[model samples]
Target: MASQKIATLVLVLGLLIMPFSIASYAQIPCNTVYNDLYPCLGFVMGGGKVDPACCSGFKTVLGLAKTKTDRQGVCSCLKSLVSDATDGEIKNAAQIPKLCGLNIPYVISRNIDCSK
Candidate 1:
């Protein structure tokens, strides 16, 4: 009887939680995340590969700069994100706005492929 009750309770809990879980798992906009990120990266790398350690610091600084509406501060912060991201991720992220149908001429122009 105890086992049966436990099973029933588990079933009820699962059913109750399923909808919220589904809603919570909704897709995040990678383009937005990338847009928010790549500029900072460019500021960091200036024109080089990204490093992993710089990512966390970049995110934190970017968050703070964003709150204050400081473009220069945000650019300063991107220097770090750019220093941290892998070369591949940086390249991929640069392409995100275009992939999302955004006319990010400035960002796209910065890409190595864009000039070639």
Candidate 2:
């Protein structure tokens, strides 16, 4: 009876957790961000008004980050991109979210620790 109860409890727990696990695993691809945000590069590097497409891309990326792991994945991708960016571009990146009227939790910087 005790063994049956344990098995039933385990099955219940698994069923309860399955949907969350699936949702967590369904993060947007990192490459998708690169493709979406590509239009922002010219403005980010050149000190001009960001394009409307750039803002739309930023909104899409923000919307995809529904979990902590997803957010961290984005941070990692941003870190790599920023590493290759000019200082001016990095500055522009930091301002992009605010400029777009979006509230992102992580600052866009090469030095930001994405592990958090």
The model with the greatest TM-score is 2
**Candidate 1: tens digits of C-alpha lDDT, residues 1-116:** 55643543354334333333211222322223334443434333343544333354335333543332243333332232233345554565555444434332244222222221
The ten-residue window of minimal lDDT in model 2 covers 15-24
Angstrom error at residue 9, model 2:
55
**Each prediction's number of clashing residue pairs:** 5, 0
Tell me the tens digit of each residue's lDDT in model 2 across 42-97.
57756589888889998998888888888887777677566655576689888988
Q: lDDT for model 2, please.
A: 0.70
Q: How many angstroms is residue 11 displaced in model 1 relative to the true structure, after the best TM-score fit? A: 39
The superposed Cα distance between candidate 1 and the true structure at residue 106, in angstroms, equals 4.1
Clashing pairs in 2: none
Candidate no. 1 TM-score: 0.28
Error of 1 at 24 (Å): 32
Off by over 4 Å in 2: 1-26
